[model samples]
Target: MMTEQRVELAVTKSELGARLQTSESQVAELKRENEAQAVDLSAMEDRSNSTELQLQEHKTVMEELKSTVEGLKGHIAERPKVAFSAALTDAGSVGPFNTDITLIYTKVITNIGNHYSPATGIFTAPMRGVYYFTFICHNYGANIRFGSLLYKNGERIVSMTDWQTSTDHDDNGSNAAVLQLEVGIRSTCVSHLTARSMMTVIITAPSAASCSSPCEQKTLQHLQRLPALPHVSRRPCSTFSGFLLFPM
Candidate 1:
């Protein structure tokens, strides 16, 4: 009986030791899991802080861009607007003057900046800039030379002439120029006709029917005195127009 009791006590002690060893192993695994979770939480916190910093920087840049855009808008609004268009007249015809005469464009079609004068038939530049100018002339006569000249500050810049000797009594001519004008510069169109005496004149008359480019001019030295000079039409067909292309 004593031997059996010893064996049972020894076996019970061995069983208790095995159970304690398993419990210790489980505690160690639990500790390792907790440490891994702590490291993951720290990394997540760093990422979140980085994201917030980037967002703040982006917001500041957007605010600066908005301010710059508003300033540009104000600058554009303050720029001057310049454009003009005018016609000679509604009357039948304008000129056969013995000397050069500035054609008055009394009919104002569009005068945006009011730089063109219907009173003086001149366009005064309001600011230094590049401008585009165009003019049209219509003549009504047979065997008569007629045209207009664009003058800048009293000097001729360009001229357009149309002479017709055929049965067609109507002729049309137009010219355009792009010019860099300074402030206070004046531009005008004039009847390009010059006559020294009633019997003769230096004009842009075609010597022959097939006069080539830069056609030759003839002197009307002994030609019969013209009863009435060819008339430049005062209708809207004869017009002067200009606009600001870009500001310097």
Candidate 2:
């Protein structure tokens, strides 16, 4: 009986030892899993921070672009207004085509609030397209030939002559002329009419035309003021005005 008891005790002790070994292996595996989870968490945090920084940079760039656009709008809104006027001489004959009776006077009259000086008033052409030009001349009863000429860059583009006036006593004749020009060109009108005569000229962009590369469209608005002139006893004379329009 004592030997049997000893064998039973030894077997029980061996079983207990094996069970403890198994529990220790399980605990080691759980510790390794926890360590792996910690590494994964650290990696995820790093990526999140990088993404946040990138988003902030993009947001800042967007804000700067918005500010630039607003500043450009304000500058355009503050542009100055352009205005002009002219007067005729008293008691003079207009012309027989190259006659000295035609007198021309030009003046710049800007608004008090938004005034532009002549030095800065001249605008550069914004495109390389075609432009349309027109001139009109009105003659009172001077019986003299009346005409108007358009000049571009100091060169004549078109000249109009009165077809109704045949003699020096002819009255109430009017003339008009039209021409086409290239963009980036500067021009003016010359009036060859008697005293108390009036003339008007206009230059505008051509439809279906495109601007040159790296150029932008400019804004143009008409503002005019007529200057008073002395009364002439010859014929009732007409008045004059001028205008220019930008990119087509």
**The candidate that achieves the highest lDDT relative to the unseen native structure:** 1
lDDT (10s digit) by residue, model 2, range 1-248: 99999999999989989989988998998889989988988988898898899899889988999998899889667543323333233344333222122233222332232221234322233333333333333443332333454444434445454433324333332233332334444333333323423232322223321111000001001112122222332322433233333223
In order, what lDDT does every prediction score?
Answer: 0.61, 0.38
Tens-digit per-residue lDDT, 44-141, candidate 1: 88988988998998899899989998998987787778998887666554544555445677889999899989897777778888888887655554
Best by TM-score: 1
Colliding pairs, model 1 = none
What is the Cα-based lDDT of residue 48 in candidate 1?
Answer: 89
Candidate 2 steric clashes = 3
> Which residue segments of model 1 deviate by more than 4 Å?
1-47, 153-156, 195-235
Q: Worst ten-residue run, lDDT, model 1? A: 208-217
Q: Candidate 1, after superposition: displacement of residue 16 in Å? A: 8.2
